[model samples]
Target: MGRMVPAKAAFAGLCSSLVGIGLARFAYTPLIPVLIGAAWFSPGQAAYLGAANLAGYLAGALLTQRIAARVPVRPVLRGMMLLVGVAFLACAIRLPFAWFFAWRFAAGFAGGVIMILAAPAVLASTPAALRGRVGGFIFTGVGLGVAASGTLVPLLLEAGIAATWCVLGALSLVLTALCWRSWPDAGVAPATRRAPPARSSLAARAVVLEYGLNAVGVVPHMVFLVDFVARGLGRGIEAGAGFWVLYGFAAIAGPMATGWVGDRAGFGTALRLGFVVQAAAVILPILTTGTLPLAVSCIVMGAFTPGIVPLVLGRLHEFAAGDPAQQRALWGAATASFALFQAAVAYGLSFLFAQTGGAYAPLFAVAAAALALALAVDVVARAIGARQVRTRRSVAA
Candidate 1:
């Protein structure tokens, strides 16, 4: 029972993501078709709203870093979850584009706050040996969110978009209430204060660039995979929903499996494996047409999507030479950079789809290529680190 306590705390941290990310940020993907069907906005307008949320996320990521030491994370996390609930309810109001954008942006911002705070706090509270497992558990919330939204939104859409939005908001409120006391206190871990690495460090550059590219990798699945399955492939909405549910369940496995691998093989090696798997997953749908193939593609994509970040974060800390401060700074920078890249890609890919008359093949291809590039960058960074070590050894000798 005592052994189960930390895992329980991790589950409480999971609510931060279940509400902030699962409901607030990711629910939009499955709900997109309903929004268009209900004529709440045109497809193009919806694209902009998606971009707006990413923009808000970027702002929030940056702000979390700046206020890390000054602000208590638990209160901020609770407040952010509450704000996410409010934003979801606000979406139900028949508002003009500007107001809708504001609400979506607010939700995105709250998601960012939860992402930045929840897992780090959990890691701090947990013993070192359990850190990897706890992280895997916490991030599984992303998949849970994806699964919940995929399953629930379709049923709720029967009652119209407004009701769907309100029910989701209410669900978030209930979750927030249930997990209210689970998170660790503010001082549990170094949520904010980290030593900064030198600007010219090879590992620093590699991790930052890898973080940016990681955002690109997720864009295809997160933003367009559902539409691709349902509309592009003529699979229908039910098929799309099934794929999403598969993605969620598979994603739950991704972090747990990969976290164990990272513990055994090392974070850097695990991350490289993740990059290869994710890139292949992105390209699988493009290469095949059968139901089974597409379903496998969805599962592969889903598993890797939420799992990779914890690995990257682990790698960042590993390369930070045991400096807690540097680890924190790099984590913040990576988070902010990821948000910025995602925001840009959201708009750019949307524009590309519009220009090409909604052709999705090119988008997935681009995302796969971007992941390949990230992997290459990590390889070079590792090479640089090895060279630096050799030079230091020669001097000492």
Candidate 2:
């Protein structure tokens, strides 16, 4: 029972993330052109709808911890999963733009709530030594959803868009059922005490800020990558989707690979390295859009997309110092920060894409710049932390 508990909790987290982010958020990427082509919406409307999800994600992130405080964590997790499933089914009908937007927003809201709450709920039961690996497994659901959507969306398109939405909705509900009994009922109870002061420490703030900036770094690829390959670069939708598939495959490997690195070299070190590599990848399109360069760019960017989540979580766990309540609070704040930036950037970039007349290079350039700035902030924060440790050690001596 002891061993089974952790395993089941981890599996439950995985299913929640797969539904919340994987299908709810990422599955829409490949469908942009399909929505436009089917005359369901114009290109600009499709882009704005994508932004709507991020807006709802922001709302969910801000509210999750507060909701968890009043309600049990397990029911909240289950409800959010079911909400995402229903959102997909509701979106299947070809309705007014407002109707689709509302459903997309609902799905995004559920994703944000799940993303904020699920990992911490599971990790509360995970052993300290295994948290990194367990977290990696939990987030791998996002990549799995991505890979599944990338591969399945095109095939399902043959049947029609409504059918594709139905299939995704059904899959989400099935996953929810499989994990229904697996959640840890007592793992993430409401906090009755105040968090430690360390929650506001320099390193903790830096991690949250860096996470927010990462949201900026990812917006271009998340929002525009498929459209860029399809319409901006003059590749057909099939070729664009091929790149998206490549992205999904790379994403599948990202979290586990980074988690292994975090366990060995330390989460902080892995995070800095990720920023540098991601910056390089984000800028590749600006320098050249050759097939090889684009492929390399997509592979690297995709891997780090969901890959950074576990790294950030592990780093924050270290700061929380084994206090599950503090960890949840810290993580909630970090997630809200991330969602806020992501929502703002998504809307801003969508506007920029329109202003620039569908130009893609500038978008990538902006993303790369955000990553570079994140790296700089992280470096300064680490330096200050190390110096503070040294000062404290000297004083004790």
Please identify model 1 stretches exceeding 4 Å from their true place.
1-5, 186-194, 198-200, 320-325
Per-residue alpha-carbon lDDT of model 1 for 107-204, expressed as tens digits?
Answer: 98888877877777666545555555667777778778878777777788889888988998898888788777877663434345455554437877
Candidate 2 lDDT (Cα, whole model)?
A: 0.87
Q: lDDT of all the models against the reference?
A: 0.78, 0.87
Residue 91 in model 2: lDDT: 88
Candidate 1 C-alpha RMSD relative to the actual structure: 2.6
The digit string of per-residue lDDT tens for model 2 on 1-397 reads 1363467888898899999999898889778879999999999899878888988888898888678778778888899999998999998988899999999999999998899889988887677667777888889999998898788887888999999999999999999999999988655676666666774399899999999999899888776887899888899878887898899988888887888788778898999999999999999999998999999999988888889999999999999988877888789889999988887887788789889988888888889999999999999998988898899999999
Model 2: ten consecutive residues of lowest lDDT: 1-10
Model 2 bad stretches (over 4 Å) = 1-5
Q: Over the full model, what C-alpha lDDT does candidate 1 score relative to the true structure?
A: 0.78
